[model samples]
Target: MSFRFLPDDPVASIKLRPGQTVMVDPSARRGGSCLEVLEGVARVYCPCEETEGMTLAFLQEGDQVRTDRLCSEGICVEALTPLSFRSDAEPQEGVGFDSVNEWTLQLLRIRHLGNAELRLHALLALLVNRLGRRCGQWCDLPFRITHDRIGELIGSTRVTSTRLISKLRNSDQLDTPSGDNNLRLSAALIESAPVLG
Candidate 1:
């Protein structure tokens, strides 16, 4: 849960190791400044005292998070993989898409599902579709998220998420091998997610 404050000076780029978090203070930047991911993946989350660590979005290479539109307290970006991003990007014209907003909307939708299992399934499908890639027979997510974080994402308790994850493992739908940082999900499991239908 430890995090460092983003430097107020405008730097060309910043890099972070996996699990490192830096808080972005919108008030410290220009009106339309943005951060453009140069490489790797990051989990963007709330930094406000009330909602600290609540993930708002996941950004990967080429994705951008607009500072002007963030909460007054700004947000925190946690390196999910070896991450690098430009800190002094100008706002692009005519690109109405906001990765944070889109992810927030989708996450909200998943939370509204009736059952925790459904929510977990939908969450996996969404993550795989948005941030993972198909391998020979499984979809591989570049980074691993903890069960507690998964529970937070799906609006469930950690114990419930662990139970559901165990079920998936027993069914051969999920694989997290020791010594590997990736999460391998069966293609069938991703395809069968009701949220994707």
Candidate 2:
């Protein structure tokens, strides 16, 4: 397998202080170039068909975010903390970038899942698989994500997300260990999420 990472010679490099936002237009991706995070956290807002407006994803270091039609009407990348990133405005073939492609495809699949609540569960499961830290059959998602953030990501209202989160928590599929804001996900429960009816 062959792949190309984002260009080292980025068209632009920017530093954002916490709470700042950058709006990226489709024109910025004219050459197939995209944005890659170098440090800190970015909260991405991309419009989705299932959304009345946009959906959100909290990306951390090494996350690649598309600046193309995948975010029709463009997208916003907000700095949750101090952030540094680069954009490769000039397109390059992603020859061996299977991970990036797979990441995008997985999100797309989650966005199009037939069941809304199932989609949310699946998204959490996917996140666990991609980003969780293993601990004796449990996976810790080392990110501070609130029910409101979950709502934004899954295209539901805050109240709804909060309720759903409580339900999932009660069901033993997800947990928050004492003194830790990070979510702990059950590996067995994540595997069983898809078949949940």
Best by lDDT: 1
TM-score of each: 0.96, 0.65
Steric collisions counted per model: 0, 3
Name the best candidate (by TM-score). Answer: 1
Candidates' lDDT values, in order?
0.91, 0.66
True lDDT of residue 196, candidate 2: 24
Q: Write the residue-wise lDDT of candidate 2 on 111-149 in tens digits.
A: 677756877888788777766667887887765576776
Q: Which stretches of candidate 1 lie over 4 Å from their true place?
A: none
Model 1 gets an lDDT of 0.91
Q: Write the per-residue lDDT of candidate 1 for residues 22-53, one digit (tens) a residue.
A: 99988898877889999999999997778747
Residue 81 C-alpha lDDT in model 2: 61
Residue 193 miss distance in model 1 (angstroms): 1.0
After TM-score superposition, what is the CA distance of residue 68 in candidate 1 from its true location, in Å?
0.9
